[model samples]
Every structure is written in structure tokens, then in C-alpha cells.
Target chain A: MTTTTIQQDLYPTRTGEVPGPAIEREHPTVWGSEADGPFDAAALEAHEQRGFTILENFITPSEVDLYSAELRRLSADQSLAGDPRVITEKSTGAVRSVFEVTALSEAIDALSRDPRVLDRARQLLGSDVYLHQTRVNYMPGFKGSGFYWHSDFETWHAEDGMPAPRAVSCSIALTPNYPYNGGLMVMPGSHRTYAPGVGETPADNHSSSLKEQTVGVPSQEAVTEMAHRYGIDQFTGPAGSALWFDSNIMHGSGNNITPFPRSNVFMVFNSVENTLEDPYAAPTPRPEHIASRDFTPLR
Target chain B: MTTTTIQQDLYPTRTGEVPGPAIEREHPTVWGSEADGPFDAAALEAHEQRGFTILENFITPSEVDLYSAELRRLSADQSLAGDPRVITEKSTGAVRSVFEVTALSEAIDALSRDPRVLDRARQLLGSDVYLHQTRVNYMPGFKGSGFYWHSDFETWHAEDGMPAPRAVSCSIALTPNYPYNGGLMVMPGSHRTYAPGVGETPADNHSSSLKEQTVGVPSQEAVTEMAHRYGIDQFTGPAGSALWFDSNIMHGSGNNITPFPRSNVFMVFNSVENTLEDPYAAPTPRPEHIASRDFTPLR
Candidate 1:
């Protein structure tokens, strides 16, 4: 596509007078061409129809242990105290998420570049892929907070300058994600619809939003309609399992008040063909660590 | 200036055949037009002639204690462990420098926006200013590492796409800077001459360079010539003192093997008119925390 075409097709959000949430159905769920490689016809059909797919034992238990240890080590790192990449819980001051996992850890970086993950991402995006964002979401037992319902693409399009919903996110569980411990919930087939959110993006919104996102969230009515129309599916599985979802998918999780803690190594892959332009909504692009401007494809 | 003129006037470094070290003397040391503002005639004249000026008691002792406490608290923050903004010493693993200090601490943020500092920065750049970079450099006793001789503009121009050397750095002494401990050393009158270093910038150079900068450093011959021609001056002072210097001035420090620790809060202010564009040398701009892309004026 020409640069002008790409700029014009920037999945509109936070625009126009009194912009409010609406279900847009123009964008494609998957952009990749080579569907035969990696994912079989059944899995591809499931993903296309459901907006997400789950793979059991995507990594071995031993690998999960290693990554879990890395998560713990990173969480305890005192040097990260004031760093913006490390977002803390609003109420508990515990680490909510740590962005830029690949750059932070060599092992995780290797995983991001691994063909098992990279090839599938390329096949899904139909182009060379770069990490749009990566993080480790940590939810402690009892006092762990939950994320509000939101579409990742709404924020990516408005605040991060992502031109289209041509991105995929992989969340690899490091700890067993039990239903009671706030496992991910998604509205099947919701990726087919784009829910544009209300309100102008505040400058440096990521500072507060990462801790507890308020903007770019679909209203309760829209969310309830989506749930009723498409039905809700929960991703609850053993450690080492993975969930792959479309960028525009409506997804969120509940508060984990159970004794079991939940943690996942999350990675987002964006098509290099769909690299960022100027933010469609915000005054400036979010920090590179959060919404990476680096379009260097994973080798 | 027009955009074309600004692009043409980019302080060239890491360009042309051989790109060897050379002293170019076309750019101005100070860009501000208002000479009758915060700085008196002698201070302005000293800054223009010597490339730097020191202000004693720029902040009070009680203020120093508060900032120092904040620094210690930030250094001990476990959440920052693997964050790219928090660079640790190569050998010791102690916190070397914490970038984006203003975003990290309310106190430091307030300090950066304070009129005492902000007004002088406006006077130096002769335009509205934004934070190009902010960090707290912590040099622990005995094992603290020293920076190599280089011009900050070299990296800022090549990697950050800064249009010119129309920027100023303020280093506020949070701890007493004794001669025995490692303190800042600058070559007087060197800001008038731009020293282009030899070498192509490695991709993601900040990852390693922050710990111990190897690239973009001037050769021994260049350092010797500059020191002999301009003479070297050390910034040794009691706590709460501040030193403002030109962006292109040659500067470095020695290893501190003494029992005393030296710490300083460093802030870089760039002219808003001279904001970043595409990088001149590197594959991508450095992370926002290190070389901020945010152009919002410090109001």
C-alpha cells in the first residue's frame, strides 16, 4: 500500500466531535497469506471464527520453571525502582507488568526469535514481524488486581499509531493459570469488530493506564453486547501453555483473590508492512519500550 | 529556521568517507538570544568563553537531603531490575545511572521544571525547551566507574537525530563532589569545536554503552590536543551546587577509588525548535527514557 493509503486507513478512534464506541467490521482478522505453514486448516479456521486459539504445552515444564525464575528475579530487581517500563499496581505497589521482555532477558529474547513462535507470527501477519510490545504480567495472590475490559487495538491505533489491526499477541503462561486466579477471558469472534473508544488520549496516559487502564476501554453496554452476541471463552491451562489472540479482540480478566498467583510472558508481533506513523489520536507516540518504534524484524 | 535549513545544519558526525575525528567550528556554543535574563553578564560571558559555568548553592542543603534520599530509594527499588532505563555497572552490578528521573520521581520532576533551572535553560537555548534526557548518575565508593572522553552531541546527533548542538546539560550535585572522589572534568573552550568521532554506531548501542561507553569516544590524540589547547577544569563543590555546560564540550571523569561516593542529577534540555527527526547514523532512535521523543515543553 502507498504511504497515503496506509495513513488514511489508520483504524479511526478518538476522532470527530463526541466520538463514541462503535462496532466497525471493515478490517481483516488475519493478514497473512501462507496459511498452510505451521497452523493446519482446522486451527486457522478456529482462529478466524473465534478470534483466538490455545495451544497446550507450547513449552516444556522445565522451560516454564526457568522463565518463572527469571520473572521472580526481574520482579525483585531494585534497579528498576523508578523506571517507567516497570508498572506497579495502584493499590498494592506490587509490579503489575514489566515491558520490553525480549531486551531485558536473553532467554526471553531467544524465545521471541524462536521459529516456533516467529514463523507462526509471520504466517499469521503475512509479513515479516517485529515486536510491537512485550511484557510479563504478574498477578500476586489475594491482592492482585484485574485489568478492565478493553480492546488492545483501540489503544494501539489511537495512542501508538498502529495503522491497522494487523498484529497478534501471544501470552505464554509461566505459572498455571487457574480460572479462579484470573485467567484470560475473550469474546469469541470479537476480533471481527473494531470498538472505537471515547475521550481524547491524555498525554503520557501509559503512565497511569498501564497501572489501571481507564481510557480506550469499550463502554459496559458495548462489552455486554459483545459478550452476549459472541459468548465468553476463558483460557485456563497448565504452565507452558500459550494463547494467541488477534489485536482487536475484546479481552480482559477478573481479580485474582485466590491463593494462587498468575504470571504470563506476553509478546505482541506486528507486521513490518504495518509499521507506525504519527499517532492518530495522542499528541505524541508512547515510549518505545511500550509501543516500539523499532521495526527490525526478528531473524 | 526552515526545516530544510535545520536538516542541512545537523552537526555532522558518523558521516562521509573515513568519518575520522575532526574539529569543526561553525556552530554556536549558546543558542539563546536573551542575554539579559537570569544570567548576569559575567556568568553568560564565562559560559560562552569557558563552555560551562558553576552555580554554588543552587539548591539548599535540606533539598539536597531530600533528593539524596529519593536517589537512594530509587536505587533500591526492586521493580527496576531489568529495565533499560536503569543501567547497572558492568563489574559491580550496582546502579550506574537511572534515566528519565523526572518521570520516575515527583521531586526530581519538580526540580527539572523549577524556574531556577528551566528559565536558565530557556535563556541558553533561546527558545521553549523540553527534556531531551534526565538521569541520576550514582558513583559508589571504591568501585565506581568513570565515563570516557566524548561529546554528548556526537551521540545525540548520530543516534537521537537532534538537529544541532542547541542543547544544555545541568548536573546538580546531590552529594559533595570532592577532588578525591570521581568528579566531572571538562576541557574549557572546547564547546566551540565539534569533535567528530571515528566509527559507525552499533545497533542498540545504549544497551552496552550505558554500562561502559566504548563507541563515540574521542581518541587519545584528540583528547590530548583538546586538553592542551583548552585546559581541563574539574567541577568539585559542596552538595547542592550545579554546573551547566554546552552539549558539545569535551568531558569525562576518573575512577573513584576513594571512600566517598559522588552522585549528581543530570538533566539535558533541548530547544523545541531543534527537535528530533530520523536518526542520522543508527538504525533506530534510542529508547525515549534515554533520548526522549516527547517534545512537550516543561511548563
Candidate 2:
């Protein structure tokens, strides 16, 4: 079959506001061809078109194992030592997140600075990038909670004083992301439309536990419409797969009632030219782990 | 001596642009004479003019003891548990702050709801007040840190989605705020100015240990000029004393490299009408302790 026929068969565009002409063209599933290195013009073009691109086998299996081991070690140390950065669910004590992982673990720090990630960040951002923040998010088995539909740039700009949405979150999968394991789901082309919604959520002890403050959570109806129009994409991959996504992409995950763990390390790379100032004209309201102030450019 | 003379003597108008006839007239040094409750017209007027009011002996000694004990217990419990909200100085391990104190301690929750604080908050804000957030700040002896000059409104408006400066921070002194002990110092008429300064400061781990993020900090020259024009007022008082100040008033503290604790419990009451939306249109970037999403009005 022809590539266009295959594309049409695979991704049947749902009827709605997304025009028919837009769907006729092929959207590249994988970022780079087998011949391209980690950073390339094709990857940038795909990212510009779809607002996200998954780089298959970005890290070797051995490297993934090393990064996974480092994360587990850090998580164990933080949990054991009662590190203030470690936020566990109040009810289950399931590790929800551990922030500033690069600061605490030398191995993770080295991994963050690796050319494979940083070089691509530079290419995508079209400038030197700085580490906005780093965190290891653990979606544990059984009680792993799901996040509501939202765009991260909305919060970063509103809260962190980020001047623009010129940033990307590089999600390096340390574990296999399966269909039923509550992996990330993105609405393709949703980045073009910046949905404006902001409100507070009910306090949840099992996840994002601090007061459950939220912003820019698109309504269920709106999200459904957007998903139908844009088409939903699941980021299911092996441990070494990597996804580089724009900050403003509409995304969320399902509850991982599954038995396996779906852990990933996310490094937010903000462009040097797009560094944010204080959102509030007061002392930084957030702790460094939540919104970092260090704007030192990554080499 | 006459009350006017005492007022004039106690608060001599510092040289500079506080305005003409306003400076000449005797500002009420005290709010009520004898038979007034916590919420009074005079108290509001004083607050409007000078941006603060000293509610003398708002809490009885016994009540103070109860709240203080509860704070100490909660602080100890959180420290022992390594609560993520409890931030300690990296070098000294001295507790810099314990956030969301009302969530953990019943005594504090009750104290926050007390008529003395809430009723006054209602009066000042011209609307029912909701609990914005609470913290027990520990300015430990010797190693206690100092904060830079900035208006709380700057943060509230920029970071927390607070629409207006319709908020008051009722600071109940847990320990005596002595001059040498690094207590709060306010620029008497700075609320009217709303000086717009935003930048990064020299990293200070002793206070604001998270990221040392700050905004609208008046330049040293401006601060010197403001201090010279509007003389600084220290909120030094006995243990049972309470001071209610406007959110926009520029204030800060000194380094308690001194041998005394200047701990205080600050309950921020935001006007219901002026409740904050998200600073950005995204998922809440902040953990709840810094900017609460709970808009449940204080009964």
C-alpha cells in the first residue's frame, strides 16, 4: 500500500473542526530517519508540525538500565533519608515525585548534560538551553493517580514568570510504557490552540498533593472535542525510547491500576533567550524544586 | 502628655513626599479608646492611612501559649517526618519555615478562625476573607536568615492569581519580636508606591532556601531613599501581640545571627472577592504549600 493509504488507514481523522486538507498530509510518527543523528533538521520540522516527536532508541538498553538504576537509588535514598524534595502520597506513601534529581544525583546530572539530550534541546529551541527543572515522576502500581487534561506552559508562564512557551520537556522512559500502564497521551496539533483555563482542584492526598492547585485544565467537553479533532496519540514505547514535546501540548495520563511501574525522568529545557522572570513581583512563592531560578545556560 | 503630642512624638513624619495636609494632621497612634471590639471603623481608617494596625493583646496569654505549643508540636512532628513543606537552612539545619501550618495543627486552624483575626480581616478587606495560606516562620537564634524587601501583593498578583491587593497578613507573635532579633521592618507608606522592581538576588540559603526567588525588590538606593523619607517601623511586640498589615506594604527582616528566636505565625487572609486565579493558564506549577487552592471561606 502507498504511504498515504497506510496513514489514512492507521489514523482515521475524526470528524470535527480539523479540516480535511490538513489530514491528507502524512504526519511523521518517528522523528528522525535511521540515518539521522540525535539532532537533525527533520526532527525539528516534525516537532514544528506536530508539536512532539518521539526518538526511538534514543538511549541504548544499557544506558537506560544505568539511568534507571540511578533513579531507583536516588528514590531509595530520598525516601529513606526523608528528603524534603520527595513527595509521597499521603494515603499510600507511593512516591509521586522527587524534584531536582540532577542536583541530588551525580549520575542523573551527568545524564542530563549528555549531548544526546542537550544537543537536541539546542536544535529544537534554536538557541542554548538551560535546565529549567528536573524531576523523576513515579507512577507506581495499583494506586498510581492520573493527571487532568492540561498544558504545562499555562502554569509555567502564569506561575514561574516564564516569558514565553519556548521550552520543551524531554521525557526519557526508564520503563516500558504499555497501553494499559497509564502512559502519557497527547492531542496532536493541540499546541496551536492555547486553551485558557485555570482553577483549583480538590485536595488529593494520593497525588500532586499540595493543596491540589491547578490552572488551565480544559473542560471535559472541550478536551473531548480537541481530542476528536486533533486525534489522540499514546506514547507507548520500550525503556530506551524518548519523547521531546513542546511545553504547551494538551496532555495527561490514565490511572495506573496496573501492576507494573511506569517511571520516567523529565528534564525541562528552557531557552536562554526565553528565560522567565518572577511571575509575582515578590519573593519566589515556589520552592526551587517546583520552579527553578538557576538560568545558567547548558553548554 | 496629650494624645496628639504623643502621636506626633512617637511617629514623627519622616521628610519627603507623603503628601501635604495628610502628614500635618495627627495620625491615630492607637485605634480604639476602650469599648471597641476587634473590628472597628477607627481600626480600618488607621489601616487605610498607615497600612497596618497593632491589635494590642488580641490574644490572651493562655491562648498564645496554646497556639505556640501547637506550632512547636507541629514543627517538631513535621521535622521528624521530613515533611516536604518544612524547609530548613541547608547549612544550619535550622528550620527556616513550616508551611501550611493550619492543615496539620488543630490549634492553629482554630486560631485562624478566631473572630479577632477573621472579623478584622473581613473589615479590612471589605469582604469575607478566606484562608490563603499559613506558615510558622522560625527565625532561629544565631542562624536565622533575613528576607529581602518586597511587597506580598507583588507575589500574590504575579505568582498566585490574586486579582487585587485585598488581603492582610495577621502576624501573631509566637515569640517577642525584638529589634535586634531580626523582626519585620516595614516602610510606613510604601504600600501606596507599589514599587516595580524584579530581579534575582545573591543566593541566600539561610532564608528562602528553596530558590531564593524574589521580585519587585527596591534597589538599595531606592530602599535607602524610601527608608530616609518614610522611616522604618519595626513590628516589635510582646508574645500575645498581633499586627495586621496590608499585602502591598514593602517589608523584610534582618539576619538573626542574634541569639534569640523571632518566630511568628503568619496567617494570610485573602478577600473572597479578590480570590486568585492561576497566575498562568496551565496546571498548577506550584506545590500547594506556597500558593493554596483552597478557597473555603473562613467561618
Candidate 3:
């Protein structure tokens, strides 16, 4: 029998809302209820069972604008994607500027403490919570680049007793997700099974590069909404809309099928069980250093 | 209240009968479960919440041969720790040789599928799990370097869903962890609190060096098992013995006080939820090129 497909729309009127059923699916076991007080059960249960779940409207409209401006500035100086490696530079083009803008922005810090957002994370993460690491995926046509599908843990090298990641905060949508425009796509349940490394050497690429990650077979039916029509979950909407979900989710972003750039700021807040390995890499409080303003609420 | 410290011998005597709580305090959360079939719960859970747990007979008796040999070879090398960054080279005496040894041995490969060990991991990581990275912390006293309390995630540079570290795996007892020999130590619940960064520049010699990660605290009593009498714990143990726990937990090793070199294989692993942002940098597995017969697993 063919497996049923599901999609979810985090924000209505937004560009890419995952189709129905994709948000939640049946599973053999129940998980993540241990720290249930602060999270949306539906979203997390979906994550525990489905490997991933999306919560749209995680970011406010105002925050979206703030991210958009910073993204525009970061990408403004970018020249021709520059081979997918995230580079911190001092050039003067859309792409280069975008990177610079991101590096200099406080947006990441704000999201780290966005009470509205962290409250849910706190529930999922248990009482004590700390910022892990943050990066802005400013996907612009002229400035930003597209990504490949892979798990995040594939890159980490472990020390003893350290906490492995379970949940994540992925905020996106400067432009709504679109099929051709490079919206996000994921492989359902790929989180559990792991393939040995292909013995490929790591490229010098920073966080943004995806081609180097191990690629897996994504579900054909699971990629669509009703009737397998919508493979790409359009995340378009007013700026500042972010989606939060577990990192194990098999998701990928489509190449910006639209003309303009697709921008989003992803900030991950882990449970107190997981702490920042380094102090310098702690999470910032906002999507960008918007007007040098502090958007972090009292945590 | 000062937590009571458990000082049970990490080693099982020849007469030490089957499973018991004696090993629980230092074992990874995985060992002994019903799904894996059969568990010594009474003997297992008897320890203090298992701040650290060890997997008994994790490495085959024969595999222990490799550790003994390698430790012997390094102990003789005297200046093997020549470069601070070199830490200790793979079997070939080259830092880059680790890649060459991935497929080299049967015993090492078996270590990957060792049902006895992976079974425990499955219990901790659910049905799905992926080996995150593998590394060997081979150090002789000549280098005289010691690590301070910190998480392993610092190297990821914080992208992907790869939050700081979740759990750590280290097999102790090249000869058995002891205060005199510089064993590994932990501050137990220290992971429950947040340790802020000192705000050092990345380029600062003090900022990025492992030798510089020192954090000053009043006492070692607050630490779990890693803490010894004087704000320290080497957590050392015999070969073939391993310890796994949360990364944020306060832990570190002391200088090798023993005349013999200290060598232990600390392979880091992660679940799908943890490896999203960075996928390439995981540590090296047993080098495939080297014969398992050539290397030894620590006591």
C-alpha cells in the first residue's frame, strides 16, 4: 500500500505552507513529552514520530522586516554565490554586503531570547535553556545560494558527555517558499537510519554549504500536500515569519525559483541539557542588530 | 547540600560477577535494556543517577591488545606530542593518517557493529542512530597539556542543527583511571547550569586553544565523578572501558602523572536530530587501512 502524505502551513497567506498531513503522521512510539509544559504537543509529537515538524508564524511580521533589511544588506555585495562556502569578507557588493550585514547584525542574538519563541523551546528543552549556535541563511538569487539535503549532526566532532541536538529553531521566509524558487524540502524519517561516510574530505565551506553532506532518498509521496501536487512548501509571506522544528526532520529548501532572493534567519536554542561548547559562539538576541535595538525579552 | 561521591572501583575483578550497579555511574545511558533484551536494573540503577557510566567489555578482549601496544609505542616515543595541535598521530605517526585506518581492521569494524555496544546506544538514541564522529585522545606527559571544562560543539562553528554537544564517549583505563595517573573527571550536575563565555576574540591565542579553556571554580565537590579531591578528576580507567555522558557536564583530564603514557579512544556519536547544520567534520573511525591486529584497545 502506498504511504499517505502530509503537509503543514505554518502561516497562512505566507508563500509556502506545507501541505496537510505532513505536519503530523502516525508513529509506533511517543517521545519528547518529558519536558511537555513549554511546547506545542502537536508540533513536537510530529517531530518525535515524523522526524520533523514545522511551526509557521514563529516570528512576527515586524521581525521579518528587520531580517529582510539585514539580508538585503548582506547579499547586496555578494558576487555569484562564491561556491557555497560562507565567507566573512569586506567586499562591496550585494552578496558580500549580505554576509557582512549578517556577521554584524544582532538578529541572531534577539531570536536566541525571543521569549515568544523561547517559551516553546523551554517547554521542549526543560527548565534551563541556553543558546547553541546561530546562522542566517540569507538565500538571495544574486546574493544567497541554494542548499542540499543532509543531517546537521553529520558535521559535529564529539568530545565526551556532550549533549547531542534534538530540537531546533529554523526561521525562514523573506520570500515565500516556492517549487522552482528553491523552497525547503525534506526526507521524512531519514533521521533514524545513518549511512557510513563516503570517505569524502571536508571542504573548507562554513555552515551554508550543503553539497558536501550525505544525501539520502527522500519520500516521494511524503513530499506533497493533497494529491502529491505540492512538493515545495511555500514559506513566502510578510518578512519575520520563522518556523521551529526538530533538527532530525528531513527537509530541504528549493533553489529560489522566484527572481528575488529568499531570506530567513535560523536561530537554534537547545535544552539546558545542551550547552554552548564555546562562550564566543553563544546566541545573539535578534534577527539582526536592527537599529542597534535590543529585542530580547526578559528570559 | 554536598552530593555524596561514589568511589567504587571502575574495574571488575576476575571474581566480579555478572552485571551490577558498580558500572552504572560511568556508563553511557545505553547499556542493559529490555528491548536489547535483559538488564541488570537493580545492579545498574543502584548508582547515583549514573553521572557517568561504562560499557563493560565494550571492546573485545583481543581488541585490548591494540591499546596496550599503542600506549607502549607512544610511551616510548617521548616527544610524540611534539605539536600542540598534533595531539597524537594515528598509527602511521601522521596526524593525517587517521583517514587511512578507517577500513583497516576487522576488530575495529566489529567495534562499529558490536551488538553489545550499539544495542546500548539504540536504547539511548531510540531505534535510529548514526555514528557522529570518532577521535582518539592519545597523549603522553611530554606534551603536558590539560583540557578545562567545555563542550565539544565549539568546533562546529555553530551552523546546522548541530547544537553544542549532547553526549560524549570515552573508554578509560589504558591502565585504569586514577587520581595519580591523571584520570578523566566530571562535575556531575555542572551541566545543569550555564557557563557564559569570556568574550575572547577567536584569533586570540587564549580564545581558541584547548590548553586555554580553563574555568576557575572554588571546589571539585560540585562536580559529578570527574571531580577528585582538589577541584580535579582524571576519570582514568583500564583499557576496553568507556564512559559516555552529556557534553555540558563539567569534565576534564589531568596531566599524566604516571611515567607511562596515557591513551584512550574517545569516539563521539550523535543522533539525526543533532547533525543538521554541519555534516562533514565528524571524527575519523578506526582507520580501515590498518589491521585490527596492529592496534590495541586500552585495558
Winning model by lDDT = 1
> Once superposed on the true structure, which residue ranges of model 1 sit more than 4 Å away at CA?
A1-10, A16-21, A33-36, B1-299
Evaluated on CA atoms against the true complex, candidate 1 attains a DockQ of 0.01
- Write the residue-wise lDDT of candidate 2 on B25-141 in tens digits: 222223233233455565566677788887668788898788777767766774446777787776777666778888878888888888777767776666677888798877775
Candidate 1 lDDT, A29-147, residue by residue in tens: 66654453588767777887888989999999998988888888888999988888888888878887899988888989999988889988988887899999999988886556566
Point out where model 3 deviates above 4 Å.
A1-38, A74-103, A142-145, A157-163, A200-239, A276-298, B1-299
What's the true lDDT of residue A174 in model 1? 88
DockQ of each: 0.01, 0.01, 0.01
Residues B1-299 of candidate 1: C-alpha lDDT, one tens digit per residue? 65554436436666543556566667676666446369876677778889899999999999999889988989999998898888888897889889999988999999998999999999888889999999998898656657777889888988998878889999999888754356787888998888776677888897898777777776566766776688667788999999999999988775653345799899999999989988877899999998999999988
Candidate 3 or 2, higher TM-score: 2
Query: TM-score ranking from best to worst?
Result: 1, 2, 3
Ranking the candidates on lDDT from highest down gives: 1, 2, 3
TM-score of the B chain in each candidate versus the native B chain? 0.94, 0.80, 0.58
> What is the fnat of candidate 3?
0.00
Worst 10 residues of 3 chain A by lDDT: A11-20
